[model samples]
Target: MDALTSVTGDGQHIEPRTEFAPLAVMALTGGEPAGGQMVSFFVDDPEGTGTDFHGGSPVRVTTASDGTGTTDVPLLAGEAPGTVEVKVIADGAHTSFSLTVNGHPEGNSGA
Candidate 1:
């Protein structure tokens, strides 16, 4: 299994205040069909200081026949920007990746 840095659905690297961010997960099964297979995603915040998931953690998705899947997870506004670890599990396979969320400028209050 592999996690994409920037999924095609969003076409942007995840950052602070990024809402409904699309995350793509790919699983390799020697060409085996993956349609209808369950794929689960979760975020691990070691310091307990990171972005928030709008629909909560451990979002689930169904993979396509090509063993690919996509899901949207929101990064709440004002979240402490830092390295966020994302994990994906599918068909008994697990993979993880880290993404850096750019911090918002201080004292730049929106009008």
Candidate 2:
């Protein structure tokens, strides 16, 4: 099976300027879930912009043997703004990235 990764937003309103870093790259060698392992992705606040992921711990992205993964991580809540670092880990290997969070209001956006 092939490994697949995706990012999704919950029902919460998201800004149009929201951006995503690249997924941590990895090489799968096992045959399937039985022998295969799980991969993880992390998101962190670098500049301390007050975003969700900034003050709190890093968000994690995990991959199962099904070769499927979800990156439904959340960042800060208020309008402080901040940067994010995305990291992925697999089979002892890992990668990371950083991104800026833009400003936006909160409400029932038709998102």
Candidate 3:
């Protein structure tokens, strides 16, 4: 439910939002015109009780393509909407942002 922002290497900005759903999981991944590599994104659901909105289960999401700036993350089974922590390690190349579950900016339910 909190606002998230994505920063660029040289202090640029790209604010985006994603939706939540039955297969909702905080997405993690990115791409740049040039430079930046050896990075990994992880989502964690620390509670481990099918709760814990703040991601602590540590789900790894890979780029949609080899060099695409997109990742598809699947939420944990029976995961209830709440808060989750999304960690992005992009070799300190690009800044990261939070993608909310059940929070669709376009108001389009995947289902």
**Index of the highest-lDDT prediction:** 1
109, model 3: CA deviation in Å? 25
* Count of backbone collisions within predicted model 1: 0
Estimated TM-score for each candidate: 0.69, 0.45, 0.36
Residue-wise C-alpha lDDT for candidate 1, range 51-94, written one tens digit per residue: 55676788888877776778755545226666666677776777
lDDT of 2: 0.46
- Show where candidate 1 strays beyond 4 Å: 1-15, 73-78, 107-111
Better of 1 and 3 by lDDT: 1
lDDT winner, 1 or 2? 1
The candidate that wins on TM-score is: 1
Each candidate's number of clashing pairs is 0, 7, 16
* lDDT of each residue in 1-111, candidate 2, tens digit only: 243223333223334334343233333444343224455555554665544443344545455554545445545443445555556566665555445555555663987
